[model samples]
Target chain A: MTGLNNKIHQALQQIHAEQALKDKTKAALKQKIQQYEKQKYKTEKRRLVAILACLCLLLIGGAGWFYFTPATTISIDINPSLEVGVNFFDRVVSVESYNDDGQELAASLDIRFMTYAQAIQEILETENITDLLSADEILTISVIGSDEQRCRRILSDIESYTAGQKNIYCYSAASDEVATAHEIGLSYGKYRAFLELQSLDPDITPEELQHMTMREIRDLIDSLSGNKQNENASDTHQGAGNGHGQNSGGGNRRQGR
Target chain B: MRSEQEVNKAIERYADTVRRLCMIYLKNETDTEDIFQTVFLKYVVSSVSFENEEHEKAWLIRVTINACKDVLKRFFRSHTISLNELMEQPEILEPDHTEVLEAVLSLPLKYKDVVYLHYYEGYTAPQISRILRKNVNTVYTLLTRSRQLLKEKLGGDGLE
Candidate 1:
């Protein structure tokens, strides 16, 4: 090579000799390689544990959701106006009310965690409903917006509840009829009128009343009032919400909003 | 892939060459050690099977060059560590040798690399082009320009 290249070569040799990898640096790199190999082994183990933990959490969460959530919601609207939510094991887990009377009834009774039968017994004993019920009066319990399976479960529970009880006949109205009643702004009043109308005429069944529209129920109530020549009968039916003290033999219980 | 024993031997053989490349690129112990560890670690873990010692040496040199480039690119427009910081102890050299070495280091980054590969490492222009992934003509042009710049900086003694 040339003189300059020769000189550079000599200088590079000196720098190379001076800058050899320190013994400490070589040992440090060897240690790092060993650590890297060990880390590779643990990576798979850690990832598998993480996946298993995630699966366990998912299973627990699914079981909790299935157990805690209500399987059926039974909305009883006999002017007492309460919704009883039953779990998979037929235990009442929730009681919600849509009106003032139901609110008072809900507060007076802590029926949660009781069996469906016990809860219905509690509902019957509450002054909220007992005051509204006459000896021969039919209690109309309707299922709110729910699936067919849940509706069947709720209806079955109510039947079982009223079987042993005396003078308490539980009639189930269609969920659609209840929805229509709610839509018409006088669900509880119309439901009470329908029940009274049913008891007056044994031919007019619960299914027949459930099928009738709100206008039909109103006309039927007016015609029945006229036939009885009861002047206060029309007032009781019309002013059910206003005259809470006048318990006019059947038709007048305040509609729950 | 080299066996563990082979890898250890290769590390001993080429560790100084990588250290020199890192010194030329980065001018601090921290940066130098970082590149040194990376180069050896790659040698230990790489799966490529070299044809021979020359191929293995060339691959190591290429990896070293690329590693140095990465370090420099990280701080390209930011602060550059000077060669003064790199020279742990000034080697007692003849005036010509010291002056030439300083002039080469003072050259631009691309030119400094080509000059070091050609002169210090005794690599041909074509070999440097392959190692640096540069065109042969590009390497020759850099060498020419760098020699000219060094001539100006160190007078006639630059690349005589």
Candidate 2:
């Protein structure tokens, strides 16, 4: 068995040795290996990109949660004050005050889970606001940890509430426009008017402009510029509708066209 | 994964062995070439760390056999060219060893596989059993039956 197996082995070896793999086949095999390597690299890179994209999405979601969240604390200071802490749904969580007058007012008012607008109206009615805000006094309204849009909307609401009242100017500290104007040594109301007047007629009298609100001065400027009854009557109406800060000048500054 | 240079070296060393195994199992050039490529491509893509060159060789043999089996299962078995026909074909098998080679090829696949691994590859029965995933007793039985068949086909005389 051993002798015959050896001879058959030798014969098969001769047969095996005689046939060689063609050069083309060897080259094709190498090419296949190279292709496989490239495919593996691409798969690895795609996996890494997918992981990074998920991480980036997580980071953006976290930042957005931190930035655009609505405020929990709506601080209304008619000095005698009112501070209300609310949730994202605008339900009042707690109401507290630092001063004795504010404490007394906070105790008297029941603003729990009340919408901020309702709470403000309730506080105004509950407190003797006339005594709290006497002549030569301003009310400061600030919202903490909130986006600008919500803060400005709430500020506008409060400002409208105090509009016809005597000796009350609302300072909306959270408003960007208001804060930037205050930084530049002008109240938000006056600065807004300055911008409007400057855009309308650059040479409009900027003198004693500080004493006028946006609407009073815009109306004064409209009467003086004589463009109020012009062909663009809709534009004039739009301006009147959106006017902010109405300060009464000494009289009217409508000097005539 | 094997590097390009490492893969190239492996192809150089083992391409002929794979071809020989395929040739022994299948007689068609197309089938042989198909299995040859599959075996090498699988080696390139496999992440298995071989213990040594012998282990790698055994892996290639086993994969080539499995790949051939898969192809056999996938397609209807075409009639393989008989060794008598191969011997008659010009410039195919050398005339001197064609008789013994034909005798080996004429056996059944089960017997021929053990014959090739034992005689040409020089593996022991235990080693053949491991490579072919058969019992050692089964491998020894197949080898003995194959020898008897080869001797009977070759007129009961060993090749000179």
**The best candidate in terms of lDDT:** 1
CAPRI quality of model 2: incorrect
C-alpha lDDT (0 to 100) for residue B125 of candidate 2: 97
TM-score of chain A considered alone, across all candidate predictions:
0.54, 0.39
lDDT of candidates 1 onward, in order: 0.64, 0.63
Per-residue alpha-carbon lDDT of model 1 for A1-257, expressed as tens digits? 87667766776666652335555456766687768767977997899999999999999998877766776656665544677777787788888765665677788898888987788787887765655554223354544434566556565666565554422333333445555555544344345565667665667654455434333554576577565446335434533322121121244443321
Looking at every candidate separately, what fraction of the true A–B Cα contacts under 8 Å does it contain? 0.51, 0.38
Off by over 4 Å in 1: A1-23, A31-68, A127-132, A143-154, A164-257, B1-13, B22-35, B38-110, B119-138, B145-160
Model 2 residue B147 CA deviation (Å) reads 1.7
| Candidate 1 chain A lDDT trough over 10 residues, lowest sum | A240-249
lDDT of 2 by residue, B90-120 (tens): 5546677777777776677678678878888
Write model 1 residue lDDT over B7-88, tens digit each, in one string: 6677678877876677566766677777877787788889988898878888998898888888878866322345455444
Which whole-number lDDT from 0 to 100 does residue A36 have in model 1? 78
